[model samples]
Structures are given as C-alpha cells and as structure tokens.
Target chain A: MSLVEALRVSVTALATHKLRSLLTVLGIVIGISSVVSLMSIGQGSQERVLSRITAMGTNLLYVRPGASSEGRVRGAQGGAASLTLEDATALADPVNVPSVAAVAPQVQTFAQVVAAGQNVNTQIIGVTPDYQYVRNSPVADGDFISDRDVEARSMVVVLGATVADNLFQGGSPLGESVKINNRQFRVVGVLKRMGGTGFGLQDDVVLAPITTVQSRIMAQRTAQGGRTVSSINVQLAKGAKTEQATGEIAAILRQRHRLTGSDDFTITSQEETIAAQKEVTGTFTTFLGIIAGISLLVAGIGIMNIMLVSVAERTREIGIRKAVGAKRRDILMQFLMEATVLSLFGGGVGLLGGWGVSRFISGRTFSGQVLYTVVPPHILILAVAVAVATGLFFGIYPAARAARLNPIAALRYE
Target chain B: MITFSNVVKVYKMGSIEVPVLRGVSCTISKGEMVAIMGPSGSGKSTLMNIMGCLDQPTSGTYQLEGQEITRLKDDDLAGIRNKKIGFVFQTFNLLPWASALGNVELPLIYGGGVQRRRRALEALERVGVAHRARHRPSEISGGEQQRVAIARALVNNPSLILADEPTGNLDSRSSEEIVAIFRGLNREEGITIVLVTHERSIAENARRILHFRDGLFEGEEVMA
Candidate 1:
C-alpha cells in the first residue's frame, strides 16, 4: 500500500481506540518531559555559576599566606603566619609594580557583634579603602571606609548590609556604636546588600581598618613580632597584561618575603578559579542530562509493548489486508506509522509539559531565575529525536509480526 | 485452472497421524463453476483450503494457472492469492466494526491506492446493497452482511472466486437470492467459481459437482 493509505489505516485504528492509545503515549510524555526539564535546569545552573563568578570583578587576584599542602601548613605546625602587612605594602608600591591598581591586606576574625542586646556572629573584615573596588562592594546606605579612616586607626567599622539589619533591627547603623568582642567601635558606614557568593553571604559581616583589627581586636601575635595579615586582595590596572602584572607582583612579594624557590604565598587570579568552576559545573550538567535520558529508554519500552499488543489484537485485520493484496512491506509500514504517530504525539505533549514546569519553577525560587535564563534549544530537539527514535526502534517487532503474517491462515482464522 | 496431483494433508493427534486428504488428485479448468459436496468430515473443506492456497499440501504438486504453487514461498503464494483469488466465508467474516462501504473498500485499500470509494460503491451496486452501504455488519441482516462480504471479495476483480458454505446460515429466500447472484456473476462475467457445500439444492446450481467420500474425490457429475 502507499504510505498515505498506510497512514490512513493506522490513524483509523488508533482513533478507534483513542483511550488506549492516549494512555500508552503518556509514558513517552513523562519521559520526554523529565529529560527536557532536567536538562534546562542543569543548563540554567551552569549559566548561573558562570555569571556569578564574572560579577566579582574581571581583573581581581588574591594572595594568601602559606602553602597548606594536604590541609597542613607547610612551615608552622598549627597555622602558618606567612603573609604580613609589610608584604602587601611592598606590592602596592607603584615603583615596584606600576600595573597594580590597589593592594589591600585583610585579617578576618569571627566575633559576636552586639547592638541594643541583639548579638550575631559575624566576620570582622579588616581592609583599606582599596578593598571596596577590589571586591565590588557597593554601599547601599552610608559611605565606605575612607583612606583617613585607615590612616588614623579610627575606632569605627562599616557594617555589611545583613549585619546592619541584624544589629540595629533595620535602623540606620551608621554612627551607632556596636561592640565587637566587648570593644565598642562606632559604626562608620553601612555597606550594600551584596548577594550570596560561592563561600557564603557577602553581606553577613562587618568591616574595620587593618590597623585597628590587628592592634585592638583579635590581637593575634606571630613569633616574628610582626603584625600578620591572612590574605592580600590585589586589583590589576584596566587593560594591563595579566602575565606582566603577575611577574612584577611575584618579584615584589619575593623581595619582601626574602624567599627563593619555595615561595610561602600563593598568588591566584579570579579568572583561573572561575574557569575551573565553570568546567566543573558544565561536566555536572552533562552527567545529569545523561541520567535523565534513561527515563526516555523506559518510555520506549512502553511504546514497544503497546505496539506488540496492537499487532496481536489486529491479526485478523492484517490477514484480511494481506489476503486482499497488501504487500508485506505495506503491512510493515502501516504498523510503523501508527507507532511513530503515537510517539510524536507524546513528544509534543511532553515538550509543552516540560516548558510549563520549567516556567513554573523559575518563577518560584532564586535558582529558578537562573534556569529561566538558560533555555537549551538543543535539548528540546534531542527530546523530539529521542521520541522519534523510540518509535522506530520499538515499532520494528510489531511491524515484523504484521509483515510475516500468513494471508491464508489469517483469512482462515475465526 | 486448478490442478492437484496426489495431494496429502495429515493431522497429528499426539503421536498418531490422521490423514485428511490421502493422495487426492483433481483438476478444474478455467471458467468452470464447480461444487464439492460431501457429508461432514469428508475432507471437502480441506480440499477447498488447498485449492484456495490457504493450506499447502504436505506432499503433493498443486498448480494454479499452470504455475507450480506447491513449493512457492508464503509471500509468493500470498501474491497469487491477492492477484487471482477472492474468498467469501460461511460466517460472512465481515469486519464487524466497519460499515458496508468500509468493508467493501478494504480489498481496494489492500490493492494499493486504487479509487477505493468508487470501486467499493460499484461492488456494492453489483451486489444490490448500494443503498445500505452506510450500515455496519451488525446493523444489517445476515443476508445483507453476506452480500457485503461478496462485495468485498469482488471489489479487487480477482479471476477466481471461492465461496465456502455461502448459504449455510441463510434462510431459503436469502439463500436463493445469494445463489442467483453467484449464477449471474459466473455466467455474465465468465469468472471461475469454486464452492463447497453439502446441500443438494446448492450443488445443483453449479455446472459440475465433485463428490468426496473418504479423503479423496470419489465421483463426479456434469450438472449443466
């Protein structure tokens, strides 16, 4: 029979049993929906991570003290006090590294910040004026810590947005005195509400001058009788060659630390770390997409089962058709058409369902916002291809059965 | 033309073999209207099945239109059946769900992209059931359903028509009407017809009669 005739017959057969056909195709629908939705979500998360990393300044780099190989400080037994405030000052000197924009030494300590009996455990960050530009910290309410604040060792701190909210109950925290480890420090400014970072919430801490933090709070001591800084935040000049800047910065750090082959400080660029994070996220999404594809296999099995049953049920009809002059290929094509139609219908419904689910989820949560942004078109096409392939693969057995039917016996069959 | 040479059909019940057609041999020429008459269990239906290519002889040479069809593959035999033969069953084996027009169109559909509706309507018109084409098999009388089946058989315009117990379930009036239609088709179109029946009156309408006693043709008589 011609393909048009075969399609007509198969469609008529399916229309005759609409409920059964619909129920059978539902399996494929669920399978395709799960695959498309999961892939969209994975793609969305990948984009989210990439965008978040890019948002933390393009030319920013970090220098931390001591090689903690295997989580053990290389030099000191307990904790390595390798980086010092003098090393940061040496790197900041334009004569040594003119490509450097700003270099800020930081010392972090956990302390209970108290204001009007409300106490919250928050990180106390010691930074200079340059820290704001390096970290992309925006002030939402009051001014950021200035150069004067760092020079005079001002007994003042800037509250991160969340810390301001927690300590003063949403009131203005600037000019209010908040005790850090029982030492009263007047609030100099309130920082903006920076969203979450890879490490934690960006707005969940208080900022202070590096001099005040080292001399008054924490009071951490090193055996060398030198003030210690945990890490140095470095910002490179716009359009400066990264390789040249790294080389110059390394020379300055080497001279300041008086080190040779084995350096105590680790200098890493934000770009390199972000690239690594993107690679990991990309791999994770691909793995998730593969796992979701398995459900499509199960759906294909369901289609195969239904097609086999349809062949069996329509044996007499097949016989009559063959007896009346239907070629074997005709019968085969008829069954194959029916199976393909079922799968295509299922795929269409699945696409709609997947899109609906993705849209709904994206409207509800923060992660969903990222998901909505990264809709993968290839995944949709793959889903449809899987559905069509399922039809072809599963339709074979039933089509063979129909094709191999003996015309005479089928006619003789009661 | 149909020819059977020492045809053998055996049935196995456990290990014992019961032969249905034991080396039966027969021949019928083109354009001949013949009926095979016998008592029940006389192997007449077995002969009809072999002649219709519904069953191959276990060990024998059968030829249709001078072609040795005995050793032909199932698909090759199906091709011959489709191109040359039409069948009308005793139960009127019309697809119950299809309308009279749909049942008649089935053969044309299987014939691969002919003017299905026109051929179907013409077949129904020939069977004198054109007005009842929209009625399903169950909605029509038994005689009407038989006419629909005959329309289905004739729609493909096969050269040979096989009718097995065509009037076995019909009343006398309906039986006469069906026999008249068969006689007219055979005489007017010169199409060869093979019928299987035990009724003497039905056997009398054929041009020749072959009688089966045990598992072979025992006697023959010229009827017209």
Candidate 2:
C-alpha cells in the first residue's frame, strides 16, 4: 500500500478510540515538555552567571599572589607576599606593557574602626587614587583622595556606602574623624553602592592612601626599602587582546622578579572566568537533560504498550485487511504509522507548552539579575527528533507482531 | 479457472497432528457458480481456506489460472489474492468504525489503486447499496451491511469470489437477495464464484454443489 493511504488508515483507526489515543499521547507530551523547559532553564542560569562575571569589567585582569610551594606541600593561593608596589608601577608604564591602560595596587586587611562610640570591624583597603577609576567606583558625596595624598602620606580616608551608613546613620560623615588602629583619619568621601550578590560585599570597605596605610595602619615593608601590596588590578587598553597582554605582563614580572623558574603571581582574565563557569553549567544542563530523557524512555514504553493493545484489539480488522490481500509490509506500516503520528503530534504540542512555561519563568529577578530561559533552535530540532525516534524504536515489536499474524487465526479471534 | 489435485492439509495442535483436508480434488471453470456443502467438522471450511490461499496444503498441488500456488511464498500468495480473488464472510465483516463507502475502499487501498473512492462508489452502486454508502455498518440493517460487504468484495474486480457461509446470519429474504447478487455477478460479469454453505436451498442457487464429508469430497450435484 502507498504510505499516504497507510497513514490515513492508521489515523482512522486511532480516531475510533479518541480518548485512548489521547491518554497514550499524554505521556510523551509530559516527557518532551519537561526536557525542553529544564534544559532552557539550565542555559538561562549559565547565561546569568557569565553575565555577572563580565559585569565587573571585560578588559580588566586581576593579578594575585600565586600559591607558595615548599617541597611538595603547597600553601593556599595569595599566600606568597612576593608582589610589591614597584611591580604595579612597572605595569602602569605604556612602554613596558604596551596594552596597559591604568593600574591600581591594593593592600587590604581587616581592622577595627571607632567613631563617636560606634565601633565596627571591617575590611580596610589601601589603594592609590587611580583606584577610583580602575575599579569603576566613584564617590557619591565629597571629593575622592587626590594623587598628592599618596605622596604626602596623608591620613585621609573614604568610606564605602555600608560603612558610611553604619558610622553616621544617614548623616554626612565628610570631614569627620574616624579612628583606625588607634590613629585618627578624616573621612573625605563615600563610595557609591555596588548592588549584587557574591561581590556585593564591596560596599562594606574603608579606603585610605597606600602610603598612609603602610606607614600608620600596618607598618610592613619588603627588604631593600620596597613596599608590599596584596594584589594589582590592571586595565587593558581598548582593542588589546587579553592573551597578548597577559603574556607581556608575565614576561615583565618574570624579568623584575629576577632568576625565576616560575612566576610568583597569577593573571586571570574575564574570559577565562566565564569559560570556567560555562563548563559547570554545561554539565548541569546535561545532567538535567539525562534525567528528562528517562521520562521520554518511559513514554516510549507507554507507546509500545498502547500499540500492543491496539494490535490485539484490532486483530479481526487486521484479519479482514489481510484477507483482502494486504501484505505483511502493509500491515507493519499501518501500525508503525499510528505510533509515529501519536508521538509527533504530542511532541509538537509539548514544544509549545514548554516554550510557554519558559516564557512564564523568564524575567524573574534572582540575586539582582534578571533570569531568562533560552531555547536554541537545535534544542527544538533535537526534541522532535528524539520523539520520532522514540516512537519508531518502541513501535517495531508490536507492528511486527501484527504483520506476522496468520489471517485465519486472526479472523477466528473473538 | 480453478483446479486442485489430491490436496492435503494437516493441522498440528501441540504434539498431535489432525488432518483437515484429506486428498480432496476439485475443479471449477470460469463463469461457474459452485458451492461446497457439509456439516460442521466435515472439513468444508478447511477446503475453503485452501481455495482462498489463506492456508497451504500439506501435500499435493493447487493451481489457479494455471499457476502452481501451493509452493508460492506468503507474499506471492497475497499478491495473487489481491489481483485475482475476493471474499465475502457470513458476518459481513465490515470494519465497524468505517462507513459503507470506506469499507468498500479498503481492498482498493491495499491494492494501491489511485482512483479508490470512485471505484468504491461504483462497487457500492453495483450491489444496490449506493444510497447507504454514508452509513456505518452499525447504522445499517443486516441486509445492507451484507450488501456493503459484497461491495467491498467486488471493489477490487478480482477474477474469482469466495464466500464462506455468506448468508448464515441473514434472514431468508436477505439470503436470497445475496444469492441473487452472486448469480448476477456470475452470469453477467462472467466471474467465477465458490461458496461454502450447509443449507440445501442455498446450495441450489449455485450451478453445481459439491458435498464434503470427513475431510473428503463425497459427491457433486449439477443444478438445472
């Protein structure tokens, strides 16, 4: 028989028992819809994480102290205090690092602060004035520290938004003296609020001039009259490739550190961080997809069960068709067609259902970022392909059973 | 034309073998209307099944239009049945879910005919059930259902028709009408026909009647 006629016959047979057919299709619909929505949600979360990482700055690279290893026992990252303020100065020079735009060196420690009976222990960051622009933070009220403040070792300080709120309780703290480590320093400015999770703690810091922080707060210095810093934040020039700049910075650090087999610092670019996050979310998406695939397998078994029942219930009809000269191939095609139609129809509806579900879940705010589900074209194609394949895979046995029946015996079936 | 030469059919039930057709031989020419009459368990149905190519004989040869059918494969037999034979059952055997027109179109669908609806409608017209074509078997009377079955049988325009107890469930009036239609197909269309029935009055409608007893042909009577 022609395929079109066989399909018509299958459709008519299914139409005879409408409720039964729909119940059979429901399993597949649920399976495919879950797969689509879960995968899209997973992709959405991955996008959210990558966007958060890039929000800090794409062209900026962070240089931190590398792990210090002593005869196979390795200390944690940032344990080695090998980086110094002179290295930050060298990175800021355009002739030494051509792709360098600006550099800010930081020396940070947790310290207790007191102001008018209010005392809070918080992070104290020592940075050059260029930090205001390099870290993309600007003062909301009062002026930031001047470049001359670092040279003069001035005791001027800037409060983060959270510190300003805690110390003054919504009152202006500019020109007010706050004591850190039993030494008085006047607050000159308050940093703007940087709202986000994971990095939102940036709003709870106190900033001071690097020279003043080294001389008064922590009185620590490297041998040979050099000054130590915790980390250096380097901003790359526009149109500069991160890999090239990273290589150039590594070469300069290796030369300055002198006789180094390995560099004592680590350079991390924004793309690398995003790539690491994508790997995590990709595995999560695959895991969710595998879980959803189990339901599709169950749905396939359901199709097989329904197809078998249909073949048994229509044995007499099969006998009639066989008696009228239907070959085994014709009989097989008819039953197989019925199963494929059921699954494909279910898949089409399920795609729409899943899309609706994802859209409903989209635009929800989580941790200060808008979450959105992404349904790529390949996902839709893969879903439908799997549905059709499930039908065919589970359909073969029942269709073969129907096709192999003896016409006389089937005619005699009650 | 049809011919059978000492054909034997033995059915195996588990470990035991029971012979249903024991060396039966018969021949019916084109345009002849024949009937095989026997009581239950007398092998008349078995003989009809072999004649319809629904079962193969254990031994001996049967020829339809000079082709050796006993050795043909299942698919080849299906092809022969599709192109050269039709069947009518006593229960009407109409697909209960389909309209009379759809039932008539079934054989043409299997035969891969393109002009199926037109041919099915024509077949329904030939059986005088054209007005009832839109009704399903459940909606139609027993006589109309049987007519629809006959229309399905005639839709393929096979050279031979096989009827198995074609009127066993019908009233006398419907049975007579069915027999009249078979007689008309034989005389007017020159199509060969073979029917299985136990009623002597039903057997009398055929041009010849073959009596079956205990898996063998007992005798034959020619009608005037």
Candidate 3:
C-alpha cells in the first residue's frame, strides 16, 4: 500500500476509537509540553543572567584580596585585607598598569542606619568618585560624592534606590541627615535602581567617601600604616584585550604584594565571571532537560503499551487484511503509522500548548522578579523529532508482532 | 487451475503431531464450482486453509496455475493470494468499521492499483450491493454484509474464490441469495469457486461436491 493510503487507514482506525486514541496521545502531549516549557524557562533564565552580566560592562575587572584557596585548605573569598588604597593608586597610574583606565577602591561594612524612626541594616560602601563610572552606577537625584568629599573626609553619603525608598518612604532624602554607626552623615544622592545581578540587588547599598568610611565607620590598617580596602574595581581602556589586561593586573598585584610563589589576591574579569555563571545556568538547564526526557520516556512506554493492546485487540482484523493478501510489511507499516500519527498529532498540539503556557506565565512576577521563557525554533524542531522518534522506537515491537501473526490463527481468534 | 499431490498437514501441538490432511490429492480445473462437505473434526476447514495459501502443507507438491506453490516463500504466497485467490469467511468477515465499498477496496489496496475506488464500486455493483456501498457492515443486513464480503473477495479478480461456510451465519433466505450470487458469478464470469459447507443442499448447488471424512476424501459426485 502507498504511504498516503497507509496513513489514511491508520487515521481511520484511530478515529473509530477516539477516546482511546486521545488518552494514548495525552501522555505524549504532557511529556512534550513540559519538555518545551521547561527548556524555554531554562534558556530564558540563562539569557537573563548573561544579559545582566553584559550590562555591567564587559571591559570591567574586579581585583579583590585573598586567594580562593590557601596552601592546604580553602579560604573565604575576599576575606584577607591585603588590597589597600595604595594598590588602587598604583593601578590608576599608566606607568604601573598600561591597560588600566581608572580604578575605584571600595571598603564595605554592614551598618545600622536610622532616619526619622525607620531603621534598616544595609551595606555601607566607601568608594572614590571614579566608582560612579567604573561600576556603571549613576546617581538618580542630587549630586554624587565629589573628589573634595574624599580629601576632606566629609561625612556625606549616597543611598541606593531601595535604601532611599525604605528610609524616606518615597520622600526625597536629599540634604537630610542620617546616622551611620551613630555617626551623622548628610544624604547627598540616591543611585538609580540597576535591578538584580549575581551579587544580589544593586539598589540596596549605601555609598560614602572612602576616607570617611576608613576613619570613622570601620578601620583596618596594615603594618606599614596603609589603609586596607576590600576590593578595587578597575575599568579597562577601550580596545584593550581583557585576557592581556587581566595578566597585567595580576602581575602588578603580585609585584606590589611581594609574593613570589603565588599571589595573595584574585583578579576576575567580566568574561570569566559570565562564563562561570553560564556554566551554572547551563547545568540547571541540562538538569531540567533530563527530567523532561524522563517524562518523554514514560510517554514512549505508554505508546508501546497502547500499541501492543491495539494489535492484540485487532487480531481478527489483521487476519482479514492478511487473508486479503496484505504483505507482512503492509501490516507492519499500517500499525507503525498508527503510532507515529498519534505522537505526531500529540506533538503538534503539545507544541502549541507549551507555547501558550510559556506566553501566559512569562513575565509573571515571582518574589518581585519577572520570570521569562524563551522557546527557540530549534528546540521546537527537536521536540517534535523526539516525539516522532519515540513513537517509532516504541512501535516496532508491536508492529513486528502483528506482522508475524499467522493468518489462520488470527482469523480464528475470538 | 489447482493441483495437489500427497498433501499432508500435520499440526504439532507441542511434540504431539495432530494430522489434519493425510495424503490427500486433488485437482480443480478452471471455471469449476466445487464444494467440500464435511462435519466438524473431518479436516475440511484445514483443507480449505491449505488451498487458500493461509497455511503450508507438511508434505505436498501443490501447483497453482502451473507455479510450484508448496515451496514458495511466505511473501510469494501472499502475492499469489493477492493476485489469484479470494477468501469468504463463514462469519461474513467484513470490517465492521469500513463501509461496503471500503471493504471491497481492501484487496485492491494490497494488489496495488490506482483505480481502486472504481474497481471496488464495480465489484460491489456486481454483487448487487452498490446501493449500500456507503453503509458499514454493522449498519447493513446479514445478507448485504455477506454480499459485501463476496465483493471484497471478487475485487482483485482472483483466479479462485474460496468460501468456508459462507452462509453459516445467515438465514435460509439470505443463504439462498448468497448461494445464487455464487452461482451467477461462476456461470456468468467463468471464475473458479471452491466452498466448504456441511449442508447437503448447499453442496448440491455446486457443479460437483467432494466429501471429506477423517482428513481424507471419501467420495465425489457430479450434479446436472
């Protein structure tokens, strides 16, 4: 028989038992829809993370103290107070690090702040004026900390968007005095909300001048009487290679720290951080894909089960066809086509359903964040292909059994 | 034309051989209406199955239209069945899900033809069931269902039509009508017809009747 005729026969057979066919197809539909939606969610989250990282500026690098690992044991990241303000000064000079554009040294400590009766514990970061451009943070209102603020050790502060909202309740806190660690500081600026990143929400910090934070809020001094800073954010010059710049910065820090065997600091570029984050999200996507694959597998077994039952139930019909001169291949193709048609129909419906689900739930706020789902065309194609393959793989045994049936015995079957 | 020599069908039920057709030899020429009459356990059904190519004989030299059929492959036998033999069952084995015309088209489907619908309608017309062509077997009467089965058997224009108790499930009126259709087909189209029935009246309608007893042919009679 021709393929078209075979397909028609299968469709007719399935149509006769609509409920049975639908139930069988339901398993495949659920399996395929879940796979598509879950994969899209995974891809969407990964894209979101990568885009956020790229938005932070690709030419940026972070220089922080302490190696991730010590000689025999692992140490907390950025725990050692090895980076100092002098290191930032050395990096800013073109003579010490040629690819370096500007350096913003920061010292961070958590402190309780009070403003008019509202009290909130928030991260206090002491940063130089170059931090606004280096970290891609710009004040949304009022003026940012000026260079004179750092030189005079002025007790002026800038609040992040979240901090400002919580402390002043949507009211402008500009020129208002807030106490940080019981030290009075004037709120000079409010930073724009930059959303969340791998480091948590950027809109929940407090910024002040580096000198003021070192002397008044928290003090950590090295043996040489130099002020210690937590990390140094370095912006590389445009057109400078990130790999070469990272090597240059690591070499400079090693020379300044005077360690021969290994540097007591870590230099991380934006590309490396993005790659590491990608690995994490990639693993999460793969894990979800595996779970989806298991459902598809179960659906495939359901297909096999239904096909076997169909073959057995139609033994007499098979006998009639065989008696009318159907070849074994004809019988096999007819039954196999039935299974494939079921899954193909289910896959088509499931693709649409999954797309609908993705659209419906996409941009839905969960815990104050909008979740996204992205379904690529290749994933759709792969999903349909997998559905068809599942049908074929599971249909073979039942079709073979039907094809091998003895005509006389099948005719005599009740 | 059909020929069988020393045809023996031994069905082994797990190491115990139950012989059905033992050393039975027969010849059926072109354009003959023959009946094989036997009671239950007399192996008439088994003989019909072998002649229909639905089962192979244990030891035999069977020839159909001068081709060596006993040694032919399963697929080759199926090809022969498609092109040269048609079967009508006792229960009027029309697909309940299919319309009368669709049932008639089944044989031509396996026979590979582009004019399936036209030929199937023609076959249904020949059996006087063309008006019921669109009706499923379940929606039609027993006589009409049997006629549809006959149309299915005749659609491929086979050299032989083998009927196993074709009217066993029909009333006397329907049985007579089915037998008359067979008679008309044999006389008008000169097609070979072989039927298995235990009813003497049905057997007598054929031009010749072969009596089977205990897996062997006992006697034969030619009618006027």
Q: Rank the models by lDDT, top first.
A: 3, 2, 1
* Clashes per model (N, Cα, C within 3 A): 0, 0, 0
| CA lDDT, candidate 1, residue A96 | 90
TM-score (C-alpha, index-matched) for candidate 2: 0.87
lDDT of each: 0.83, 0.88, 0.90
Number of the top candidate by lDDT? Answer: 3
Give one digit per residue, the lDDT tens place, for model 1 in A1-414: 777878888898888889889987998899888887877777777777766665655687788876544443355432567777888888888889988888878999888889988999989989888888777776777777888888888888989887888889878877889888888899978887766533434688889998889888867665467888988888898888778888898888787767776776777888788789878877877887777778888888888888888887888888777766677888899999998889999998998888787777763556434243355888778888888889889889989988988765676665
Proportion of native contacts kept per candidate: 0.62, 0.77, 0.81
TM-score of chain A of 1: 0.87
- iRMS of each prediction: 2.2, 0.8, 0.7
Minimal lDDT window, size 10, model 2 chain A:
A193-202
Query: Per-residue lDDT for B100-210 in model 1, tens only?
Result: 999888867765646789988999999999999999888999898899988888887878899999999999899989988888889999888998987889989999999
RMSD of 2: 4.0
Error in Å for residue A190 of model 1: 4.6
TM-score of chain B of each: 0.97, 0.98, 0.98
* Structural RMSD, model 1: 4.1
Per-residue lDDT tens digits for candidate 2, residues A349-407, read: 88888888888888877687666789888889999999899999999999999999999
